[model samples]
Target: MSRNIPLLDLQKEFEMLKPELMPALEEVLSSARFIMGPQLDELNDHIQSLLGVKHHIPCANGTDALLIALKALDIQPGDEVITTPFTFVATAETIAFAGAVPVFTDIRSDTCLMDPNLIEERITEKTKAIIPVHLFGQMVPMEPVMTIAKKYGLKVIEDTAQAIGATQHGCFAGTIGDIGTISYFPSKNLGAYGDAGGIVTNNDSLAETCALIANHGQAHKYEHHLIGLNSRMDSLQAAILNVKIKYLEEWNILRAEKAAWYHKYLDPSVETPVTVPGNTHIYHQYTIKVDQRDALKEYLAGQGIATAVHYPIPLNEQPAIAALKLHGFPTPVAAKTAQRVLSLPMNQYLSEEDIRYVADAVNSFLNTKKSQSFQNSPTGSSV
Candidate 1:
């Protein structure tokens, strides 16, 4: 069977927003201001207003956003920043890029967020910050994390790349931390047409520093202050994002509705995603846990269903970063969870029929596996 359900359908999303997208692009082209244009300023203003943050600095991409946030905080060589191992490499890569060591912490078994209970044990005299990723569109348990940070005077940077509109107990995901970073990658909840990102902070000085860092540390047109990277969002991407921002809340609601549909139809034998209490999950990816994950993924694919592993290998185990020589962190929970987690098709554009079909396919695969296991038992012949 040909593959039917996909992980995401950006084409359908574009079709829904074409009416506004075309005019926005045309406006940018006519103005001829592609860099640092009016659209960029408008997007920054809109993001600040939406998140109720004091400053919103747009950057080239999500990775750059994290790097800029770290630079703004003055995290440097010999400093250690604690973060979860079960996340996209960018979460830890940016820390190392900022000339700091990324100390790994295990995630909670249920929520898949960094375990706050294990954090204090990892802090040392060189610890400067803690980066808690809002994984799979749910906010990390910030209350406990924040308390721990306060006790040790460590700064917090919320990696909100996946959880743009998520909230916890009335606090927005990114806004709760000292510095918050968002990604506008094509797949994110609030994605632009291409690579783009933003940095958010309530602190006036940090905000100024972030803007300077993203703009090559330029105090003026020709004068350079601090060494920085060239990371800026172009006018076209900013214009596209401006149009999409108006529909972000509604799309998130649709994603939630689809998640509910998945919950209603999927077999109870498999594990479904658990929303952290007091959190509004945007369902960037409707991930589930199941035994025999690799075999089940192949089974689903053969039945025309698409599945993905968000992170098959934890950051600490990736060979590419072996030069960091990180070791001795107890991350049993992260290591175990990485082997079993599977992401099903999830997006605002999915239909009820699409959700039902995917769930039915998964159920069929699991049922077959169970039958095979029972038949292979030693006592099967007697029965």
Candidate 2:
């Protein structure tokens, strides 16, 4: 029997772009400078220009980008960084990696992004920074989050992992915070062939620090400045990104169009996704909440449709979170969201027929109360 549709078809993406990609790969192979080469520099310059930021430091991956940003801000042991538990593990894991504690801030139930209003309540003497994840490509309430951050003198790191080209209130998603991190994972909107990540910042001091940290703490050859990790972006990956970056806007537009279709065609029995005001989303995952998430997912799978869960367990409920055990985190919204949210197969390459098939399957499943066979897996790779 033939299989159901896969979540994303990277092979198809490559096939469509092979003409442009082949030459770039050949150029990189000819240069033979694999690390921190001209290709990487060119890609960084392109990202900086596109995002309207001063510095765009390319790194090994998104997780490392966040780690470097935290390190640059001088986050250390005993410092508390406020973040949402409804996002990918990397959002909080980077804070922990920087020897800081990730204080779980709940999300807005509607947008599933961090609730800026709740951030102040979590801030304490130990709170040194706030990392608001732009979850599912929707911008967080940044104007309010920034106001709270400025009042408290805390660094803000926007985790734009799933929202590279997304915009809000006429400004880009990654440009709103002091420092922003973006992933070029294979499945992202502007993903590369393998792992790649970039950090954007307007602060000169922070940019210098991030660059140094990603380069083994080296200011010069054999001259170590600070303790750091080896997290440089490779030239080959940069070449791949250079080719894809040009199409990000168009591809994201396609994703947005597909999302609109889903929103219009979703079963009346199911609750649809919520879009925040003044946000122009890229629709990274096109996620939605429903009454019977697992059942719906399975039903879709049986009908040759694929679905995923952005997160099934809130951060507070995770085994890694028990160690911190903060008093009264109150993740009621995050916890409830974890159980009901589901992500349909969303990609720039998806067709109108594909969207209709998935929607029809969903409506059918919801009506008959019959579920298809599928694993209720978490969306984030680390999870």
Candidate 3:
């Protein structure tokens, strides 16, 4: 059997960092202080410096990061938070978790981030914040979102889970908003060995508030300030993250190079991905628009090239959120995007040969159009 191409190859990344990573892990293990330790503090400082933000609060996962941000801002039940539908459910899920209603906004057909133009129509007295997710490692056009937030007295929480290092013009994704959340989940650009996430902010008070909330609402040991969740990043994950942080810029540069290679090589008929105007893309997933996404995905699998759909369902249509009773909301773009989006193999570890192989596999799959076989044997292996 031939080697299968992985959607993301974390083992290759791990091998690259083993020399420095192992020692860090050893030190954390020796300390035995798993929760809030020196490793966590170091990783927080490293992320803060890299993103040029004043405060970094380490959390257990990205979802908790957003929830903490919303909690810190005093967003409550019945408050409306505007967000795009064409992203991971966590963006909206966290809004609901914050006890606020997620007002679904349409996305830009090209960029797939929140359509800043459509925001005003959704605003109402209940509106408290706008979460413009930096989807697929590209910064959501922050200037317009910020302007609208300023005009309406709305808070902006940047869902930067997929765009830790991505920027628009000269501004970084997480820093542009009042607060931002990033995931260091195994698949992220700056991934940890396991699940990990962080919140970044320029405001000192907001940072302290989120940190307190993440630690079971305690500002000090055994003292509960408010009802909060326990969501602290483990020392082991932080130790791994601290080692990886040093290589982030170099890895992001390689990812950019691979994205360029894909652009140069992938078939033009495939509707290759496009970046938001004036925004830098970190190519987290390298998603392309394909008319026959399911068929092509199957064909690629047959060729040992793994592929995935970043999101196959729009958030508004999710069964969990249907009770909100949102309808006739210009969801055509989101629906179409769900059917058409296909993520190709993307990681800093992919070599020139791997890039060409995946590109060729996609173009070949498109040319062959194996519709019947795909329909007949649609396996659930796009992991």
Candidate 4:
């Protein structure tokens, strides 16, 4: 029997949470206080408690959270912020939008994380901060990154968009850095009903500045103190996220279990995700690296299985940033990785049977490719 598996299915998640979510939505609709309602405060409190942070500033989306954090840190024109080129463009886009140059850095081949070894060489007098992204629900080696930041007096902003409940050595992803950002874009580990995000910080001054900036730079209503954007979290989205946060840890566990199933069953010739020591990976996307990535993706589609590429191009090669005329740094690993990475179907709702099926399909395709290659060899002969 042919099975249809999607990369991610939000409908199943919604049906499971409908019992608890409907009332929350009804309560918000009844109150008629759509924007900046009580739900936002409730959600903020829950997130702050979850991450053990002092303050949580809710915003409209993840991109805004990054921008707000950079602006609050006073990143001025010509300043440089270091980050990896392998991640989503928003990581570098926010830096450029904040009037700072995003210094691209290479990544490690094993973990696909920003190489802490390569960061210091890019530092200059104008380098003001480091934005280490926890790509695909895994933590960057923060101990050394933090050490470097301390030596250079550079601020650290963690882009924890894909990793919410992940931890390294018992320290949470967003809590380790000076400022951290999370996304609730309906596809995140702790997704909301719509676009939503939050900023986390232990620094009282930075927290206050970010909150003010998110609320139109106001010290009081209609009193603008500094230039800022109007980026507030919607009350309805907050209500949805408040409910979803309760299950985030459990969902992450299930995701990890699913990833393990893949690790056990996948072909040994393919490369699987690597988890750093003492770190808890939430498995936002169970991505695998294989040769003939595009052909394999097409083969999977024919078998009624869905797949996706997390990123098909490195940030430095993107046309959108071409106008910035940024200097190019050698990111050979990231450049090579973009061509071979493929994300498999992953969700808490998936069963063991489903995982096995996906693995079987992938192996069947890989085996076929191997057989074809051997037959095409010059020394090959029919058995």
Candidate 5:
């Protein structure tokens, strides 16, 4: 019988780390450090040293990280924050959550990142920030985004939920902007056992503000500085992250190896992900653009292979965003990619054999459709 392949099999990874994780979790329980404690401090130090950032403020989730970053930057009501609509809802939702308008920008057709060329036309006097999402494990070409931001005097927030350790032109994914937000949800490249997040910045004042906003605006005990929310990552999640952080670089390398296998084995018909110049993709999702994405996903499921669509709908087209009554620029590329992008099974533990199986499944499906007229699919794969 064929084996069942999950989109991400964290259970195997968990089992591998069981010994270290158990002792760490037990220590937190025994010390009764359920909330902020030594564990969080250690994790922060670990991340700070690795990323070479001035501060790493722990938070409850990635959404809170973005919201706190926005609040710290003083994005006021009616202020516009530009971001790509092709990303997860959290990216734009956090802007609206911070009482700022989410101005949608179109994405690059090849890489699906926010197009810097389209950004200038969207900026207005009300624009305060630009959020470039590092989607599917590759950093957006941040040089142009930063240049445009500096030209417009707009703050920048890097949404690095998927591309934690990814780099563009030697700068880490989260370090290029004014502030960077990370997600430690279990599925991330550097995931915790549950919900967790952190903020990274080189500026001292912004770091202090983010820390305060994430902790109910407390400057000191019983002293309120600004209106803030209670959003701190717990000790248990921190403890889990402590053990996992050491292996992050190794795991990302392994994931890249798995992606290579797919690239080598997939048939010529399917379009593979494109990694831009001077960028390292961690392959967080290994998304490919195909004509019949839903059909391929269904066919793979029947073969005990799991696949996922990173975002089936652009945020600007969603009803919740529509309810906000916000006017968004046209995002035809985002809308077009949303229907074609399919995330194949990608994880550190995926073997070459597993990749071949998935590629074969994809090729078989495409072969079934080969007789029909094909369009808009990039080529360059050989099985």
Candidate 6:
């Protein structure tokens, strides 16, 4: 029987951390404080120290984190927020949810990040913010984005759902922009046991606003200043994350090692991920570009090797975005990318032997396709 490898082996991760995890959970349970408890406060302090971010505000999930950010920045209806259309919908959805128009931008074919060059043309008088999504485990080139934001006098929100520890020029992903949002989705690099998220900022006012916005806009008891959402992170999720945070860097490093194995073992014909200059890629997804991506995914599935498409469609072309009646932009690269991008099994738990097995399966399929194609061509002269 073929061995089955999963895209994210969270169960294995949980087993590895269970020693500390159980004790932490016991402590949270013993304290009987579930909401914004000591565990959450401790996690906040640890995150601030670990990432060197000035302010950390915990939320229910990444989407709320983004929404909190937009509301904190006072983004109004009809305002425009420029962002790439290639990433998860939450990056764009929060903009629309905040009653702002999402201005679509193209992404770079190599890094699949919002092309800074393509951003200026999309900026309009109504443009209020630029959301640079750090797709995968890599941080987008923030300097150029920051420069553009400064020039346009627009707020910058780093959609860092997939890139928590990722850094650019030694600065953490969410800290470079005006505000950064993170998701603790189970599949993320620093994921929690349940839904958890955070907002980070260097500005004290933005920090305060985020905290208020996340907890129903009550600075003090029953003193509502602005409308807000009930998006506070619970104690149990915080306790779980606290146990996992210590291993985050180690896991990120291991993921990079696993990515290297995929490169070394896979056929050279395959297009692997490319890390942007001055960026540290945590390989949140070891995605590759290939012809007949769906076929390859199905082949891998049959081999008991799981695979995924990080995104199979661009946001601008999606039914929901279309419903907004938003003007379309030239997203040729993002559109092409949606059809070709495929993510292979990637986790710290994957061993070299596991990777080798998966790679052999991939090479076998591609090589066979090549052979068949050659044989069918007019110039074929197979033995």
* TM-score, per-candidate, Cα-based: 0.98, 0.94, 0.94, 0.98, 0.96, 0.98
lDDT for residue 283 in candidate 2, whole number 0-100:
87
Off by over 4 Å in 2: 1-3, 370-383
Predicted structure 4, TM vs. truth: 0.98
Off by over 4 Å in 4: 381-383
Which scores greater on TM-score, model 2 or model 5?
Answer: 5
Candidate no. 2 TM-score: 0.94
lDDT tens readout by residue for model 5, 172-224? 88998999999999999899998999999999999999999989999999899
Better of 5 and 6 by TM-score: 6
Model 2 lDDT per residue over 214-252, tens place: 998899998999888899988999999999899999988
Question: Which is the winner by lDDT between candidate 1 and candidate 2?
Answer: 1
lDDT of 5: 0.91
Off by over 4 Å in 3: 1-3, 370-383
* Per-residue lDDT of candidate 3, residues 1-383 (tens digit): 34488888888877878899899888988988888889987987798888889999999999989999999999989899999999899988988877799998888778787889999999999999999999998987888898999999999999999998888887788998889999999889998878888999999989889999999989788999988898999999999998888888888888899999998889888777788888888888889998888988888888788889989999998987787665437678998999999998888878888888888888877766655456556462331
lDDT of 1 by residue, 1-383 (tens): 34488898899989989999999999999999999999988998899888888889999999999999998898998799999999999999999887899999999888888988999999999999999999999999899999999999999999999999899998888998899999999999899888999999999999889999998999899788888889989999999999999999999999999999999999999799999889999999899999899998998888778889988998888885567987558799899999999999998878898898889888988998888888888776557
Report the C-alpha lDDT of model 4 over 1-383, residue by residue, as the tens digit: 88999888899999999999999999999999899999999998998999889999999999999999999999998999999998989999999998899999999888888889999999999999999999999999899999999999999999999999999999899899899999989989999878899999999999999999999999988999889898999999999998988999999999999999999889888799999898899998888988799999998998888999988999998997767889888899999999989999999988888889999999999999998888888765554
* Residue 21 CA displacement from its true place in model 1, Å: 0.6
- Kindly report which residue stretches of model 5 are placed more than 4 angstroms away from their true locations once superposed: 372-383
* Global local distance difference test of model 3: 0.87
Q: Give lDDT: candidate 6, residue 18.
A: 90
